[model samples]
Target chain A: MSTAEPPAVAPGATVAELGEEALIALITPMLPHAPGELVGSGDDCAVLALPDGCAALSTDVLVEGRHFRAHWSTGHDVGRRAAAQNLADAAAMGALPTALVVGLVMPPTTTVDWVRDFAAGLAAGCRECGAGVVGGDLSAGESLMVAVTVVGDLQGRAPVLRSGARPGDAVVHVGTLGRSAAGWALLEAGLAPRAETIARAAACLDAFRAPRPPLHAGPALAAAGASSMMDVSDSLLRDAGRIARASSVVLDLGEPEAVLGADVELLEEVAAVLPGTRPRELARWWVLTGGEDHGLLATVPQASLGSLPDGARVIGRVREASAQGPGVLVGGRSAGADLGWDHFG
Target chain B: MSTAEPPAVAPGATVAELGEEALIALITPMLPHAPGELVGSGDDCAVLALPDGCAALSTDVLVEGRHFRAHWSTGHDVGRRAAAQNLADAAAMGALPTALVVGLVMPPTTTVDWVRDFAAGLAAGCRECGAGVVGGDLSAGESLMVAVTVVGDLQGRAPVLRSGARPGDAVVHVGTLGRSAAGWALLEAGLAPRAETIARAAACLDAFRAPRPPLHAGPALAAAGASSMMDVSDSLLRDAGRIARASSVVLDLGEPEAVLGADVELLEEVAAVLPGTRPRELARWWVLTGGEDHGLLATVPQASLGSLPDGARVIGRVREASAQGPGVLVGGRSAGADLGWDHFG
Candidate 1:
């Protein structure tokens, strides 16, 4: 991360004070230029040429307090998270993210510097995944909220759907598991004790704030003959269960110790910083129920498993459903009570 | 309009009581499906086959209190208005509206019936403009907010831009001019008078509640060789000035009698229902500077003026910029105080 401090704002200066047109002008330059787009921002609509002739569309909404607390996250962090969540959806569909249309609903008290930083972070997020922020809308609201819609090109490849898993498929993942949850735990516990532990915790916090999903892994897996795919935004057990149900198969995730060896080590490092927590138990819980990591998860045929791209880890297998119904199982037992994040729960 | 009353919810039922999954299941059926879409809602991303190989995108955010009041407008009205605004942007770009991805943020106390009705209204709006609701995201927030992103197909035609207007072009418009503004005035005045006036007030209120833009006129104008085009979301003088500045020409909208004949009659009808307002003066004010009608405003070459489609009316003329700066002029002078709607100001 850059050590540069955020730009300062005038005391008590707000979005309402700056006015809509002035705020638009201020943030307009922060957007990165998108090549090949017929039109980009500043117009009634943004026009883009899709060479692949197919478009992948996805949208995600992040509300203040619910998604991210202002006290815990910077404006940049919020923007980055919002972009990552939506762009990750596009990547999960085996498409290359091309553009984003952002909608921001901010309170009048929001500072100009905050809005600018938010735009900067959005541009950075798009750059991270090889996309551009092409258009956006801004409005005043009672609380800060962001709605991001992403458009992607499939490049003539068939979209990888979650309902394609079959029996005898090897379930594999291509990004970090439980790191974001561990990071959330660390932040919640308020632990910043030793220097080494602080560095580990900082990494976890960064993962939680701005997820780095393996974007290329999606298309790689799709090309490698993966039977099914989805981004793991919810808990592995819950999200895997969705594939299981969708495909009418059972996903046996095996033991946590065997499946999440490296993740366990990271959780242990985080647990060492806190006093009354068991490292193994915490690791198991985070691996099973942690959400928001935005990792790409897919199922490959056993014969094609050798073609899995670098960083892919085999963790489970797809099997014919039995009497227990199609769902996720860990060590051959049902995962109950920890079914991941539910917005209205 | 359907005379069937909106469904009712139990007095104490809320979104929290129903849960996100249940709410989603209920509202999913309300969306109008796109026939050619490969993947629709319920997937990570909606996949659409675009025969034109190009897409026009636009987004708009509407906050509860800032854009609409729950007390003043029904949930359906809010949804329709949101859809209309985004779709109009697509039309202004001379694109055929294809799909919409909506992002909704509402308080937990919101009822299921309200959400369902909102979805119904969105579907109705899409049907009106020959589009489909392909995907969406819903989240809980402190207040009600809707962010709509629309995708449109250009049909292999060049996008109409605001910068394309030339001097001596005839400015024309299709759809209502100031009825929405007049309706807003009536709603603000809190007037509910006796029989005859009540009927007129109801018409004005309906105009404010649900704006029906001339979606078909967009492509027709483009086909008729319009020089420039835009949707009139802000007041006429203000929005016309945008075209003037963008095209480096001046828009001279002559007397209200010549520019807004039918609109004047409607404004007079609305003003007649009110007790202490002068119809002619109020008509001129609203016609000159009112907003939120979502009408199509375009400039066409003088030779193609005869090709203007039905419902389109000649409003003004584009002229070369002189000593006065390039912008809008009314009655041979700069429109001074009534510049148009400014969200912040």
Candidate 2:
């Protein structure tokens, strides 16, 4: 964990030099115009129209060192990653993301270009997810912190909640698993310094920098009658435990071979490049506990599994809670340890 | 400017010791349950029902050291202050605040009790402003920062924007001005350590620590047909300049005597307590440029001025923009220099 200072600003081109209003002016034009927004930025509040009369709201914070390293990611990557996580939360609720409000805290010495790139990346992420950046606040702080709150329109559909899973339901997942964890490991193992490793694990490194969650799959799963759903932000085992406890059911994740299936080969390839580690063991751990992928996990009736959305894999089944308590069981055994990111921990 | 470390944590009671879940469990019961909220905290996203189908959104960030000193403010005061600013923004839009989503960043060494008090203050603020703590995100950071996003319901009324003030409109304000600034100065002048000064300047200190914006006055003024409105978070002169430029009208602030009225004596009393400062001069500065009072400022036709909400005071008038350019003019002249708080500066 290097605590290196961020690169120095170019002479006289600091945030303080540009001033707050001017900085806002620089980023205002870059914001994508949100159609139907009654009010946008540069006002006391942004007025938005939610035709369905209901809104799904979620917020996430990304700290400079705790969430992303300046040396490992570009400003654009940070912005995109911040927006993606919040958007994924909206998706988890079976809603279409409509707008984002960002609160940015950075030092006065931060460069305008860095701020501009960060805004651009936020806009880009919003655009990618069919959303718009409607408003934001900027403040000077000791370090960079991006707090993003996303609003989504439910569009007349009932939100998919984590407590709705029933016994005998199939637990399915859409999007990559453990790739970000593998990428993070690669970067930590000096992969960024080696051209061969960087080239070989480019996708992994990119995943670690800016994740591309399967956002659309959320609404699709909802439409397909998902009984329960949540975004896999903390890790499969840990997140699945949330659903199990909330739904009062036991989630029995199938064997690793059945769960990983084709992805096993890719994980194995990623693991093979890392020195002093067993490829199969590392690949398995990464697949099950790797978080930050922002993938969608849902529980649906067995009958609906055949009609699941594209690329969704059926990896587990819901069972009646046992005396041992409601939680996730992998291959008929307890996971033994929680291998997820805990903020306080 | 005493960069003092926050008081040391009680032995073995750090956030890391309690863990994230335990801390969340400690605060969850303290959150106010917002009436009619489709969903509250403890979910991936909070689902809110906006019967009118429109929502006003706003966000603000408060950074440690930059925004407040831990030595000067309790965690609860910081939380209340953070929530008040965002809620005031919503009120400035002529909307009734309904919910808040907070993103809190703190160091890993922070105490669980500190976090608990912070959450309680947030809930208390929400309760005071007719809103609820819907959802939030927490992350570890180098410094403490509270990023609050408030959502409000318009209740079928059109938002009073800063751009709608017409010539001949009277600018009015509801709530105190300069009290927070005076309090900040008093604290800076070592008043906090002096029992006599603290006793005499309690109102000022409290205003600075936690502003109680006249939130109901926003919708009330809107109902009375306010043409333009905004919260006076920054200096009255600076914030007034925003409406002036947006409306393409000149804002002529009235004489200080008329604007300050009975508050003059109170301001003088506060100034009298500070050494080496002229009472009248400091009072004038505090009234014109002191920021963070979170007061509601609105513009309405002169004919409706008599029917303005309770505690509302007429402070200026809107006029056609002259060749000099649209902006705020105090006592027949430009403000001359920006004395407001500048985040970067």
Candidate 3:
């Protein structure tokens, strides 16, 4: 729980004194290069042989305070979060995580243990995701940041994107959403729920920390006659809006009660803590716009709906093409309370 | 070019308000997907297929001030530099650039234009290097940081690494070192040479800002029977130390005079402006510990030295494995003006 990093050097060593040329000296011996590496570390580029003439790729970055709380998440947690998020992006594309390259930056005061732990966490994420940390560069910074680029193997399946959705397709979801936001609302307010719920909300917090996306969802949806798909990274409505806009169609979400009805209990707790006294009000926002849970949102043929596994829902459908700025229709009702997050807004 | 970014936004719409999910949503729609993207954006993982059963890979990151000055370099410069460093790394490995995935974190106040310029800069780097920006991700953070992963094709050449040197090999170098360090010092001191040398040094400044590694060196070295090779990211001596350490041999560097003798006039002006007198002193430092020129340093069999192109130098030689740590020697001397940059130091 300590956010204590190693003490910084007095003003830290300038890159000049350390010498840029010698930067490669510390790393060249520790790597295990692939025999197929057309060119490995030590040169301008590292080349490799490609399989079946295709390349799969994804990227993610973990920032201090935003994606993680230094006091709570360890260097390992940060590393895991960085790798997992990027690996998940590749997975969302229906690619099998192949290999990864990491860009690490931290304050000079950071403990070597933190760096070592960070590497271990990265290795763990790579191992679990069927990827390896091929090579990387290190630098000093004012804050801790880890950016990971994950390469993937598609095994020849067509890449799944948000642009392929079609009218008459069933809107389905695999994995949970909105939990992280709901959990944050409670945590930031300094209100603890019942033991079980606190544990559940903590799961939500963990979801934000080290998210494990459904790696198989892209291929599964692609193979299951799904016309279009995308990872639900924004609010459900906002992400759905992307699908609708890309496909030039409309998404008619089912009843709000059917969508987030199961979360009424947690909402009631949040309601108790806040002056505003309605569970329904908070519950609706969670399902509609909550992002970062990394669940899959797909539009599949109705017949494929039966084939979906547990934890998925037939939440809505892709309607005929529409121009009302491609969006989600709640209970076939008015554009309801705000949908999701906006980066530039 | 104008480096002015977008003005700040109203409060509360901050990253925390939208969270990671919402932030990702804002960007997912803007990225263009490629056919080779077996896994595009979205999902836990992406699967890619390569024809030859191997993949080229490398990674690099850019911090706001450490790697570049936002005021000096545009957003495009940041992106181009980010891509160039990684692509150069791939090339150093004798790999042909193929695809790239970027992991970026920046302040929410950043403009869409800045991001575009950054992307444009990256595209320019890839195009100049004959590569492409294949995939990437965007997120919010307090500071601006960029992480890039580049993949390339090696055309079946053996990868050249820092550990491949053998005893009795001729140590050679192709490209300028010390230029970047010297240029950095000049700029920091607020001294400017004539536009031509200034431009050249500015190119060196650009080299440090957005390095374009000698992409051709890696594959060429492998084809030309290079025994060992590495990029001039650190100082020549320090990086040479890595190869020496890995190969358990001594790399005897000739006097700095032998290397910079021809370039004396060009360096004299640079030396005059600095308070520490003498051209040789400043020039010598350039040859010893400078970095980011993206040049190639290689070793070849003494018999095959004639095959090298012009602008190449036989800077030193390898000797019997040394009991002393793997390091550089000057006329069997080790004054040890420490070489290369280190993050934690």
| lDDT (Cα, tens digit) per residue for candidate 3, span A124-155 | 66666556666677777878777777666656
| Candidate 2 residue lDDT tens string, A6-98 | 334465588998788777877877777554589998789899999888999989999988888888888899988998999999999998888
| Tens digit of per-residue lDDT, candidate 2, span B169-189 | 998999989988988887788
As a whole number from 0 to 100, the lDDT of residue B126 in candidate 1 is 89
**Candidate 3's C-alpha lDDT?**
0.65
Top of the candidates by DockQ: 2
- What is candidate 3's CA lDDT for residue A88? 65
- Which one wins by TM-score: 1 or 3? 1
> Once superposed on the true structure, which residue ranges of model 2 sit more than 4 Å away at CA?
A1-12, A195-200, B1-12, B195-200
In terms of lDDT, model 1 sits at 0.83
Per-model interface RMSD values are: 0.8, 0.6, 4.4
Query: Model 2 in CAPRI terms: which quality?
Result: high
Q: Chain A TM-score for each candidate, in the given order?
A: 0.93, 0.93, 0.79
lDDT (C-alpha) at residue A277 in model 1: 82
